[model samples]
Target: MPASDALEGIQACVFDAYGTLFDVHSAIGKHQHRLGGRADQISLLWRTKQLEYTWIRSLMGLHADFWKVTQDALDFALDRHGINDPELRADLMEAYLKLDCYPEVPEVLSMLKDGGFRLAILSNGTPAMLEAAVKNSNIEQFIEKNFSVEEVGIFKPDFRVYQIAVDGLGIRPEQIVFLSSNAWDAHGAAAFGFKVTWVNRFGQSKERLPGKPHFTIANLLELPNLLG
Candidate 1:
């Protein structure tokens, strides 16, 4: 639990889509039997490479939408694991579009919405990808906007990427409560000046980064209480 004084003057709640609100591993979980013993490893590698590609591409000035990056990452993971089935690859990619929300997501978002805070998602996902996931998870009404990196042609950790939330919400960075399950993303949002909360769902260690989160909570269930 966070100290009571941590979050203050929060006008909006901006969340990272994957891992924060949605279960990024749910796609792989659906095919666990088929993936067999390599399921966990492939999923982990896929996610790692997915984020790595985004950062690398951002630095190289060769931006691709998250969908493409996800596909490429899945390909790499599959190849590395010696699973070369085209049907399985396609199924995994399709599954990414409909990833499940974390069990407490809807309840937490509703609580925040009932509390009168504006809500939005600032994600590396494309508009289409975000839309499908939000709609699939039935959380569309809770989100006012889905801010994608496509608008800026860059992935996250980029200062410009964080600016989308500020610009879209028409608020100062300090007024927004940014939440992300990724430690690096929490640090990035913090560096960009948002009042950050690292939703440390997987118990990841805090990154040694320029910015530090004001609070760290195990899950979104702790969010409404913290904000209040």
Candidate 2:
């Protein structure tokens, strides 16, 4: 379907927390002055490893909370870049709790809520982590609930993780509209039967996966219109 098309029968809008609603790279961006030349590289690696660990742990059936995975990813990224400062490591971890939301997030969410759509977050982040990010960004009021993988002890792309929204929202998969900036995540939600929207905030290419998104938009600013 085209990006301008509206998704019918969507009772609730479920979002991917980390990259969708909140800016994951902002954690490292906040500390770029300390790293000098390696800021961008470290930020990219940290996010890569964070996501990699989630999939790996899910496969192994050895689930850890997202907070632990986040810390471990940061450790690996810091070690790889050959910058071993305990203070920097501690500061980066703390920065993650309050990562900035995309500039359009608040307005888009407010518009959607005003339009009478139910909103919630479905993410690999633990409840505490999701809570901190939402509250920190001051968008908590817009979200009705935050669904974490901790409930099922697995990460995204797993059918079970997506079911959390279906069960919690008391709606069929087709009735929920799932949004994610992560290509694989958008594909997974679509595979699970939701109308998926790939929020291509960074202009990334589409993923070669089993399911395709119904719509693709550059940012959440286009969301309300697409839903209507």
Candidate 3:
């Protein structure tokens, strides 16, 4: 889709961090010896459990920051795959803080900034994690703010998490463009009444959820055109 009036009235852009702008698997790819042939499954499980923990914790009213949830999920994945090494765990955690950003992120973010839209990262990541990842990826110059679930001590697909953007940006929900690689996140944002763009990087099917995105694109590069 090309840029059009469909993006009219958008004053801010809020993005999900993990699996969206950053390659969540890049951290595991750096540790081939530890993961070996199970790298893919282990990576998938780590992410799956990470998200599951967030939702479960939210529902149980027992909240932990995303960093802790991430570590817990990583531990589960490591144990499930029969890989046990304290040093490996440490390395993986550190790698996560500096996850490799997608090649198109920097340019796309710059383009958005140049287009005069306010930009922020609203993520399930903690403030420290988001700060480190943004700085490490050299996108700090483009983003205007970072919003973390830590502020409310909850994970996402929750209305409260998405509320941070509307509240923080001082803009109406209809005026913000929320983007995510995860379909659930897109659905959540759409339900919250924000215009949403699902960056369907993996060619996943549309979710059968309450809210649907306004647009679906293959990557961040397509975002600029969609916003035009």
Candidate 4:
């Protein structure tokens, strides 16, 4: 795709993690394959529990951190699936550390950077997770920086989580284009005054939020064209 069209007034494109750039779901799916008949069922439980625990911990101010939340979630999922295999759980977590990259990611990020747009990460992932993902996924070269919410000790949809990018960039809110695969993150960034882009990969309907994205695209492949 050509960069002939992109979002107007967009100097930088900041991304949300866990889904936006990494194929996070693939981690569960691939590992669950070893579980045979219960693959999808168990995988779904793991992913759902992972997110649920994160939110619950965040709300309760328990703050176990994303890594701990991940492990705890997997434990709950394994119990639900009636699997007590430690090796299987280990395999699943390993897959997460080595998550697959979306095909369009490298090219799009390279093109965006070549097209002269600043690229950065704004994620709920821990500093280590974000760094590891960026390095292992081979998308690091294209990213200008990785911002983590560990500094704030909270989860996203909270205005503070989005600020990791703003404060990291040392730029005004209007100077950035906030992009996320998650609508909630998009909403939070938009509310914070960054021009938002909702990367609607699944074609999901937008949640009712006062902070709507400035652009919506099916995937990153369509983004360069859409932004223009």
TM-scores of all models? 0.97, 0.97, 0.97, 0.92
How many clashes in each structure? 0, 0, 3, 4
Q: Write the per-residue lDDT of candidate 1 for residues 1-228, one digit (tens) a residue.
A: 344555667889999999998898999999899999999999999999999999999999999999999999999999998888999999999999999999999999999999999999999999999999999999999999999999999999999999999999999999999999999999999988999999998888778989999989999999888887
| lDDT (10s digit) by residue, model 4, range 6-37 | 34566788988777898777877776558888
TM-score of 4: 0.92
Cα lDDT computed for each candidate against the true fold: 0.93, 0.92, 0.92, 0.81
Per-residue lDDT of 58 in model 1 = 93
lDDT of 2 at 214: 89
lDDT: worst 10-residue window of model 3: 1-10
lDDT of 2 by residue, 104-220 (tens): 999999999998999999999999999999999999899999999999989999999999999999999988899999999999999999999999988997789999998889999
Report the poorest 10 consecutive residues by lDDT, candidate 4: 1-10
